[model samples]
Target: MKYKSFAVAIWGVVILLVILVPLPTVLMDILFILNITISLLVLLNAIYAKDALSMSSFPTLLLFTTLYRLALNVAATRLIIGQGDAGKVVESFGEFVGGNNIVVGAIIFLVIMLVQFLVITKGAERVSEVAARFTLDAMPGKQMAVDADLNAGLINEAQAKERRKNIQREADFYGAMDGASKFVKNDAIFGFITVILNIIGGFIMGMMQNSGASWNDILEKYTKLTIGNGLAVQIPALLISVATGIIVTRAASDEELSEEIISQLFTGPKTMFVAAGACFLLTFIIGRFFMIIVAAFLVFLGIRMQDSEQEKIKQDEKEMEERTVEEIRKPENVVTLLHVDPIELEFGYGLIPLADVNQGGDLLDRVVMIRRQLALELGMIVPVIRLRDNIQLNPNQYVIKIKGVEVAEGELLLDHFLAMNPGTAEEEIEGIPTTEPAFGLPALWITESQRDRAEMLGYTVVDPPSVISTHMTEVIKRHAHELLSRQDVQTLLDNVKSSYPAIVEELVPKQLSLGEVQKVLCNLLREGVSIRDMVTILETLADYAPVTRDTDMLTEYVRQALGRAITKTFITPDNSDVITLDPQVEQLILDSVQKTEAGSYIALEPSVSNKIMQNLLKLVEKVAQLGKQPIVLASPVVRLYFKRLTEQTIPGLVVLSYNELDPSVKVRSIGMVTCS
Candidate 1:
């Protein structure tokens, strides 16, 4: 680094010498002062440690002293020079003999030295940037390793130390190769052009000068113009020379020919005046008439290039899209419902009414009506309920087997169902068994109203006695006896313990429906036996449920269900009106609900209404905190209560009847809101 710095300093000194020597006759006094100041600073820093010198005081004093002396010396030099007259020589001799020019000469020397210092500083900065780039490029595989370590979160102190050592070793190894490559790729052409341009320009200028006339003289004679004399001539010449030098340097360094033209145009006004003045202006105007011809040629070239590139890109993209489509369309990628088993039932009632059938209207609306009816009957949200195929019962009575149940009942019946051929229980009556055959017992007795309801909904019912057979009757009796005795429950438990593994294997491969599994569990639970044993059995079975491939869809569905469950369990009536939830949670729910499947609606159970209200209140609070008002538009019942609460306090809350508000107005009225 030090050697490099010294080299830069040497170049800086050389540049200073070049600038100062040519203009010394006019600028020597000032230049001399600059040189002296730099010399003094160097002397001071060398003698005393850099820190010992007070940089602020010493530099300020040196600048002022240098400037004062330079001004005095330049004035003296100008007076002595006396516009290049004989008196100027006389004055200069007088000043030298009298010792009047010593201080001025010293100041001139210092100023030149200061300029050299500035040159050195700028050169050093350029070198530093180049060195940093070289260092970065030389470290082999550093970027890849850094990226890996960062991603894996394994970048500890020891790892970092090892990485640094590795980087340093690689840097040393590759640095030579990198430098050689860069020199071959960039420096060869650049260096060759630079040397060639320098030689050409130098030869041209030298020849022009050696021809008994300077380049400027030739230019003036040819152009029939003189750019004044003395400093005016010198300043323009200096600027032109500097600009030409830069262009030549760039050309020699392999800059484009177009760049050389631009450099020449900008370097001097003379070039522009000669080449692009009135004549060129007239040519430009004429060229506009031929623009259509030029445009046609350019457009054709552009289209050809664009078409080639675009076609290549299109081909690549098409291949990629095809591959992706193939992967997504694979049969294994489809999400199938786990299982679906149909449950058959018998009805003695008449055929269902046409009005009850889901036809000529939206499926959701019909589902809503069905749900409402079920809710009215059950006094709660029925988790699962669906219509099944009709059959005739032995009793000639409307009968239904609750084949598919979602929640567990017990183990004995579950095992029997799994067995696939479960026989019924029987019992003998002591005095009534005298060759008189009995009828099969019905699971449920249908009332006339129930029968009418069933028939209205497109169902057929069987009467009680017509279909009963003696063998079936005996089986029914035996089953009833076993059920009452709880012996069947024990048998089911034993059966489950023995056959659960086999049942699970069969179910898993068959992809049994959730309904079928639920029914088996419900029967076992209802049998009043082996509830714990049945849960264990079903738990084993549940492992066989179809594994979903759409993680995002499954996750979102589970999240929504969990959110609803949380709101129901944690949100209660007491805090429904007062409790508040975080706005973030509410927003999450809102966004999730919006993105839910088109036909699905997130139904908030009545039990969870208060919690949702609390969340809305929280949103209102947040809005208020942000210096905004919350206007709630709700059903009449809600509006009335909210209005009553806010009436006694500040009128910060506004409650509007939902029916009376415009849809757009309603949306703007609240920070957040919930609707049924």
Candidate 2:
């Protein structure tokens, strides 16, 4: 590697030396021949490159080749004008082409210069400029697309990184090529001026040295050498310019230019047969014997191409069948719900504009932020969500699915704004009426024109994407406990095992299994508690798991340990109302609560259960009138049993134990639950 790098460094020094110091004729010929070889290699690489990034270094290499050619031009001018002897290459060209006429040599040089400067170089420069501008302009959208794929779990972290790198490389390559094009344009102008100057200086020198030399002799000797030098430089420069044009204009593709031309252009046999018929007709009129040969070859090639295409298709089908047979033999694929994402957000075709990053929608980015927020607030990692479009639904509808089951669906006018009454609005805002899915709030789907007025009317305004995102957040929160599997518990343990290894070592498997831990965590999350403090919960479990293996019991113990945090969360700072069970009602429940091997259960008569539920509903309504949260403070013995009893019949009742309330919190008794 060092030797190769040193050799490249040495090559660059030689180009500089060629300009500052005079070189031997033999060395000049070698460098001149090497330049032509390098140009051809670059042109061939461009023709065969599968895409522009395959030849990402072409722009830098172009600059070096252009510089080397310019150095050689300067060196050759010095040799011809100073000593009237450039090299054998210049001498042979002069004698062969313009042995008697200088006009022919000059015209040939003019033609090559014009073709390079006016055509190839000019076109390549324009292409490079346009490619650079467009690539840069599309960069933000491309980056957002990669990010969206990452959030949607279509690709993993490593794949997303590779994709992002390719995007950046494409932008960089085009920008570099834009600047590199200037080298070719300048090289063309420099080559023309160098050739003309060398010819004029040589003529002046030859006339001065040989005073009796005729004008024809001086002009003939000088014009031929100048034309030879110009051809040596311009021919390779033209090839480099063609390569640049090819590199800049080439679109990304999976196949090389040769394969693409054959696969796409010649894939159909009809065009080939039509061309063959045309060629056969041409042979009847003009004696183009080659036309008949061409016609025959086209007919043969058409048959061969069709046969090859059929073979490829048959091979592909055979491979697909083999794969299907293999898949059938394996039972995993048949029953593998493991590959299905835990959560998925599918939107309709018209709602697609809300998720597309190119259309200024960042729903995917918002999903990422929501995941991070859930992890912090809920203390469990939400699984990566898969996003897709569904055409079977309404165009403006979106469905939220949990484990492939649609749990929630909502519709949005993507062009309109959602204006929610902050519950304090005195009058209704004029627009389409819609219910906010997340909280079931009364909201209006207002147009852009009504957005400003709605806000002015004391309404909280949100965009369509925010509406969908809000709905997704609430649905996920509602189903969080069901989403917590044994796998998730193991993951949680593994995450914290690194920091508190001893706590995890003693608490899990030794005391409680992962399933027990998952159940306990689910119990806490069922009531919307943040388990971010996993260490404390694990410690509490470690202390109590020996006596009782019941998850509900373990969860109650964990809650008491987290009393201060819990009290701070739901209770207001003003130390307001604390709704407690009446002593007579509490005693009735505590006396009925029965303890057995499989946890505890509270059994009561139908009349007693009915009276207790009626009194509880009245107390709940009284708390609502006072603008305070309804929390039933009771003894620890029946709190767990009461939790299960009220779960089905009473939806919004929060049952808390006396030990779960912090002493720092002050409270006044709002009312009592009784059977009066």
Candidate 3:
């Protein structure tokens, strides 16, 4: 590790020295060979890598290698123009490699340069640009996936962090590669220019000395040396350019390039068999011996591959069966079945695309937003909702489960928009009639073409995903209290204890246990109240717990303390109309109240309970007709029992005591509920 730093430092120093100071031909030859070796190494590394991230520093490597190669080009240029002979490496390349023919040497060098400049370097640069853009565009989705996995317990914190770091590294690598590709392109241009300048300068210098050499001789000597220098430099550049292309275009794979190519290209023998037949037919038109030999070899390889494939398939099946049997034999496997998720969303196969991110579904994102929304709105952390597909249900049907028990279900028409009349559409759009899944409102499933007309007609239009998301949101809200466990409550307390430690310490375990506090919080959530102000709630509980240990009574006091927020949630301060419980009804409920060791309940007779429910239902409808929420105003002593009594008849009936309303809010009685 210590020497590694110095090695790079020395490399940079060498690059500077090579450019600033002239060197001998022998040392230049060694550096040229080393340059070629490094380019070959980079190519091999790119080919063998399982994924791009394995060579994360490749962009920096490209920059460094480009600088070093250009420095070599500079030194070679100087030597050729000054000494008329760059080195033995260049001379050998100029003569033996090019057959000592000026025309042949020039053509060979131009071909290599063109192939590098036009084909490899150009393609690699474009690929790098696209890869960089796509990687950056996909960052948010990848981050959300990591968070989803973390939330679902599929991975722990350390694994999630590592995955996130890899994602960021991948983006940075591709982005850097986008810029580095330009270096490769310009390096090719620089080489071409360097070769031209050397030829021009060498010819001028050769003529100035008046060595009695003819123009042809002077031109020929310098031209051969320039082509040789170009060949030596362009060969390594070509190899590195090819490596850049390979790296940018490479997809994530479990095997090396060679293995992937072999496995993927030859997975089936049918193509090979077809190729053998084609080759055999070519024997008539082409050379009989060569075509026949190729045909026979192909047929033999195809046969062997066919047999190997069958054996591999059988082996895979046998291994799978053995693994299954082994898993079944393990006693702990049954224990896994007993564990249940707190919340789940099971849908039919047809609706799978609605939750699949690959198919443009945003249900998972919507689920995440639902969790966040509830955390803010209800002041409670909702459990992670598991999504899965069930083959047994109708294709478009979905079921919502709480604690492994199905609580609600709905269906969707994926290609249609749900258009509901908000009680103002003058004309109905032509479509299939269906009920809105979230609210059971009468709605039409209209085609995409009809969405505009429906919306123009004042019909509220929603697509399939929104329908499901809204439905899921409402389902979670209705059952938010049920999803809040004791652990969640503890988390809430811990969050509060950070800032307001004294209140939490005073109320929890001192005045009331954790379970009691949880019961009180759940009670508030059940009635659509926010528990965000835990400090206030704790303070109220601390003040009232000594007087009574009953959670139901404690919840009522907390509710009264949060009157301002509750009033803003369901009531208008300027002009609010509500149904008032009759004095006699309050007295009757108070008279029938029964206290037990566990809690309190209203001991009203069945007939009396039925009478009260009938009266309450009438008043609720009366208030609804006035375009106001049906809120029941009752004495604080009777609010809890009244809410419990009416919950079954009117599931979301809002019952608030006079003290639970903000003092500034004006309340007018629209009707009264009585047992008379």
Range of the 10 consecutive residues with the lowest summed lDDT in candidate 1? 413-422
TM-score to true structure, per model: 0.20, 0.54, 0.55
- The digit string of per-residue lDDT tens for model 3 on 1-676 reads 8699798789899999999999999998999889989999999999999989999999999999999999989998899889887888888778865675788778877888899999999999999999999999999999999999999999999999999999999999999999999999999999989988998999998998657999888898888888888877888899999999999999999888999999888767787889889998888888678988888888888999999989999999999999999999999889978989998999999999998889999999999998899889989988988999999989999998999999889898899999999888989789999999888889999999999889999999999989988988888888878888999999999999999999988888888999999999999989889998888999999999999988888898899999999999988854488889889999999999888887788889999889989988888888776656788899998888888888888999889999988888888898888887
User: Which regions of candidate 3 deviate over 4 angstroms?
Assistant: 1-324, 573-575
Error of 1 at 339 (Å): 16
Answer with 1 or 2, whichever has the higher lDDT. 2
Give me the overall lDDT of model 3: 0.90
Pitting candidate 1 against candidate 3, the one with the higher lDDT is 3
The lDDT leader among the candidates is 3
Name the TM-score of candidate 1: 0.20
lDDT of 1 by residue, 402-490 (tens): 33322111111101111000122232111111111232122233444454444444433333222222222232222221222233333
What is each predicted model's overall lDDT from 0 to 1? 0.36, 0.87, 0.90
Error of 2 at 344 (Å): 2.3
